[model samples]
Target chain A: MISDITLGQFFPGFSPIHKLDPRTKIILTTLFIIEVFLADTPLLLALMLLTTVIMIGVSRISFAVVLRGIKPIFFIIIFTAFFNIFMTKGQGEPLVHFKIITIYKEGIIRAVFMGLRVIILILGTSILLTYTTSPISLTDGLEILFKPLKKIGIPVHLFSMMMTIALRFIPTLIEETEKIMNAQKSRGADFSQGGLIKRVKALIPILVPLLVSSFKRAEELATAMEARCYRGDKNRTKLVKLTYKPLDFLWFAMAVLLFGGIIALRILPGHISPDSLIYDILFYKV
Target chain B: MKEIIKTKDLCFSYFEYSDNDNVNQAKIDVHALVDINLTVNEGEYLAILGHNGSGKSTLAKLLNLILTPQRGNIFIDGQDITKPDLTEDELFDVRRKVGMVFQNPDNQLVATIVEEDVAFGPENLGLPREEIRRRVNFALNTVGMSEYSGHAPHKLSGGQKQRVAIAGVLAMKPKVIIFDESTAMLDPRGRKEVVDIMEKLNREESITIINITHYMEEAARADRVIVINDGKLIMDGTAKEVFSHVDELHSIGLESPQGRELINELNKAGLNIDTDALNEDECTEAILNKLKAI
Candidate 1:
């Protein structure tokens, strides 16, 4: 049951999106996330959705897999949408009148918009960043991106090294956890047949051994790393260097175009606005 | 042969606190390694055999500079690494020269991918990108893991993971590689695979090998075997010389290889058979020859 998590899962592929440099994918993912927030009108959100769909298609990741990525956060998404629906104040009559709650037209629109925004946010980042780029490359890109922070004495390399090590050990630790759980089960420890507090108490047996083993592993790993001459990014070199290809530049150009379109939709005059006409006709019937 | 690693009366102790809550508890010094003098020549296959907590691992750590000696000096390639004023760069250089493969394959790897972990040591050395690439490829190929380069480390078997760990050390191009009970967690097949690599590295690549293990068969395969008992070097000799003393090995909580044990058993049964055979093949041949003579 603990192994169902698909977070940070990379899908190996030979698509154009996968071929782009990890740094490019990371930057573009950030831009797309910002664009998701900047998208105010239905037309703009539709454009964002179109971009996300195109990306997922290009990466050859099935829609089913992308939907599964959203499954773990499905409850949070529903809570957010419902909270916005009930609590948001609008400039119109109530769409639904309950005894203690009133739902407005704007609130419904806002909730739908927010939900779509979050869905697109998850899909866009997962497709461009996590799905296409391997975890090592992703961390490598992050380390390079945050290199300038080293001047502020932030220990960027240490953090990335920690991240890489954590990623490397996640599977190992999970396997260890499973082994401990099975061992406890064989000793007649019941994990499933308990109340909330009892269940949490039951976990102590598993957690204690897991923690002890983790500390042991950490000490051994430190010695092993020391034996390998690892000294925390002091004059360290990379075997797989991150370099920009022509495809990256092309991706950058496309991102710039998207940014410009978002800006134009936000600041352009009402009559000349491409999204405004659609917004007016869709929401208020000009 | 030129000595690549030499330790002069090296000593190390771990201070165990009596009680964490007590402010004035007396700390007990657990001597992990006590005065020992040893020399590892270039391209030598030296096996350290000991029972658990016998200071063999402590000796391995001291050689790799993971643990600083409390009282003695370690000279690697004619340079003293235990100097009090040794710079960090100098320490790293010495560490790079002395690579170590640890017991657990799961803990040692720093990268998610096999190739990246192999590249880790070279990357730490700050080698050129091309040089790192070349070394990583060469290391993987040398370990026969070239195809599994792109594979995730945790998905690999224990033997494969240990090989990748060796490849990780090999990429650094160290003069000496120490296996600190590296095959302890592996199955017999995995143990054979790692021991074979140690032999190959010592024989073909001319890299000095210091394998710390409790396995008698593994010790028999090494050119020289040193037995550590209770933080002291109890026995150091050629494999044949060491394994022939079956009673001494048994007294120190170690067993001679099956071959030696069988010969001893045959000798006890009133058969005059040579007890010098250190491995099964030699023991079997010696028995056959004795039987034919009879």
Candidate 2:
């Protein structure tokens, strides 16, 4: 069960996007968010979509994988769109103007745009970072970025060690959870056949064992760490240091161009946002 | 006659359940180890014999500094392990000096690959990469697991995994190694393989070995045998001396070797049979001698 649910949701591939350094990918994801929010026109939004599509293409990961990544957040998307449609007030006409219930044209337009932006943001991130970079490489990039903190006595090696350990145990704990669930099921604990509260109560047997085993594992790991003479935070070195290659630079340059172009298109004249265009084309079709 | 490890009047107890905020507090006093005093000499192979629930594991934990003695001091190469000046960093020094191989090879193994796991201890020491690689290779070679360096530990047999675990500890270059029931989970072939490796490491490297085990035959391989029952040391001597008193051992719920058991029965039946066959081959020869006499 834990193995099936991918936590990082990273798709392993050999595409250009996968070859990019995780720090570069992480920075690019942040930049994409900024560009998405700054986009004021439908044309700029279309450019953002184009950039996402290109990223998806270069990643060579299937579009269905990215869609699967967004499955969990679909409810959040709908809820945000619903709130945007009903909450905002605007001048002029209303699409559904009932007693104290006014859904304005502008509100509908903003809702559609906001919903699209959220989806686009999720899509861009899944394709760029999660679907491409391995978690070890991601932590390696983080350790390199945080290496300067070592001078301030921040224990970067230790932090990276903790990250490595956490990543290592993610699959282990997931496997443990599956085993516990199976054990509980064999003992006639009906987790699948009960109401919400009853199901939760039935989970206690599994949870208790899981918690105990995890605590035991943690204790053993601590002992093992100490046995290796791990004295926190001083005179530590890594076997694998993060290195930036030409591919990372190329990917970085592409992201910058895409972001700058999106911003320029947003500021240009006579360009309409996707929401307003959709509402105008749909609502004003009299 | 160099001493690798010495414990002075060691005693330890576990008290749990007082932490619960119940109105009526209860104390579950578990006397895990009591009044244990022993010394392991340099390059000596020693085995501790005990059944389950015995204090052998507790003693192993104490040696590695996992459990602090509630009563006495344990000195590793003349350095007191329980000293206050010895911080956790210093305790690691002690650990490096005295490597430990746990019972469950699965739980103790931290890495996915065999070579990586072997390198774990040396890497944690912050050794140079080349040195780490060299040590990893040497340790794997010592355990006859050099060919398995690339395989996943999970894919290996119980014996192979245990050997990998031994290799991991061996990479630390510890002067002394404590195998705490490591071969208990292995099959007969695997058990013999582990025993042979332990003997080789002891003989070639001159490393002190403290093997905790339940098998009397394995204990017979040791130069000295220590038996514990109900958290106290009941007997400590050479294999011949310790295994001589079959009735005393049986009274303590300890099982002797099948050869020893047969000799005891023959003696009780008024047969003039010797009772000191340590191994099956010796027992076979001894039985043949008794048949010739008859």
Candidate 3:
């Protein structure tokens, strides 16, 4: 049951996107997510979607797998589209009206654009970052990016250790949870046939044991870490240092150019920002 | 022999909270180790054997200064970590000299990647970047896990993960490594993998080994064996000398090796055979010689 959720899963590949330094991939993914938010029209959203498809192509990972990783985004897209369809006040007459509901011509366009923006945002990040980069290197990239936080009195080394340990335990803890749930199910515990509150109440059997075992494992891990001479955030050296190669700079520069292009397209004629819709209704002549 | 580790009348106690009828009176003093005078020589593979709750792990913790003795001083390479005047740096130096590998490989590894986990110890030591790489490579090579350096640690087998944990300690290049039941949770194959690595480290690297275990077979192969019972050292000698006391071992709920048990049965059955054989091969040969004499 837990295996079906593919978030944060990596696809092993030998393509250029997969070969990019994790730091480069991480920074580019952030830029792409921001570009997705800047998208206002169908054309720009289509452009962002095209960039994600190109990244998926470069990675050689199957489109189906990358799409499966962002399955939760479909729900968000639908919910947001409906929200805009109802809440977005239109400029013209309503096409359909009920007792307290009105669907306007402008609302339909706004809903379509908003839904595309969200879907493109999810696709852009999942394909470019999580699908291609392994979790180990992702942690490494985070450690590198977090080094500046050390100067602000934050324990970046400890934070990275925490992240590494957390990632390492995800599978183990999931397996443990599955085992506990199975044990309870075998003992005639009705986890499925219950009301909402009843279902949560039925999980007490599993939760109690899981919490106990987690604490036990946590204590043992702490003792083991101490035995390994883990001095938190002190003078430390890493084996896999984050060194940018020529390829990383090339990819990073290309991503920057693409981001600039996104901003330029956002400012062109016929590209509408949601701000203009509200501006015509407030403090401006329609 | 240079005494690399010496414990002089070491005593340790910690407060343990056990669920009981009297909740307020639950803070009980648990004596994990008491009055333990022990010496571990340089470059020796010594095994400490005991049953559960017999203070085996507590001794391992004290040897590495993870748990300090409340009543005595533990001298690691002639530096007493329990000295009141010692600074934090001095304690850190003592801990650096004694590396440790634990029972659960999953709990001990601090990184997601095999090589990154192995490099964690040296990384903590503040070594140079190039030196860290060299040590990681050498450690992985020594453990026969160089090829698994880039793989995720959880993807490896139990034995492989344990080997990676050993590499983590080896990267630090400590003079001594104490295994506190490191093979207890592994299957037979994983156990064999770790034991072979420990033996190789002891023989090829001249590293002092303190193997705390419950497995009699592991202890029988060691150069020396020490028996701990009720938080006190009961017997310490060569393996042959310690295994000779079969009845005493049985009284403490510890097993003798199969050969030792067979020889003891021969001696008990009114047969005039020496009960000194420590392994199956030796016992078989001794029985053949006895038959030939008959």
Per-candidate Cα lDDT values, in order, are: 0.89, 0.81, 0.83
RMSD of 2: 5.0
DockQ of each: 0.85, 0.27, 0.67
Clashes of each: 0, 3, 0
Tens-digit lDDT track for model 2 on B1-294? Answer: 988899999999998777676977888898998888898889899999988898998998899787888998899999998887788567778889989887766677766568877877887777887888889999999898999987766568888988998898999999998898889888998899889989999999999989999998899989999999999999999998999978899988887777777777877898878658788788778878998989
Interface RMSD of 2: 2.4
- lDDT per residue, candidate 1, B123-164, as tens digits? 999999999999999999988999999999999999999999
Across B1-294, the per-residue lDDT of candidate 3 in tens digits comes to 998999999998999887775657678898888899998889999999999999989988987777777899888998787888988667667777898999888888877778888888888888898999999999999999999888877678889989999999898899999998999999999999999999999999999998999988899889999999999899999999999888899999987988778767877886778647777788899888887988
Clashing pairs in 3: none
Q: Is candidate 1 or candidate 2 better by lDDT?
A: 1
Which is the winner by DockQ between candidate 1 and candidate 2?
1
Tens-place lDDT digits, model 3, residues A40-155: 65666777878878877878888787777667668888888899899878776898899899999778888887776777777778777887888877878888887898788888
Q: Please estimate how well model 3 matches the true structure, expressed as its whole-model Cα lDDT.
A: 0.83
Backbone clashes, candidate 1: 0
How many backbone collisions does model 2 have?
3
Isolated chain A: TM-score per model? 0.87, 0.84, 0.82
TM-score of each: 0.92, 0.82, 0.90
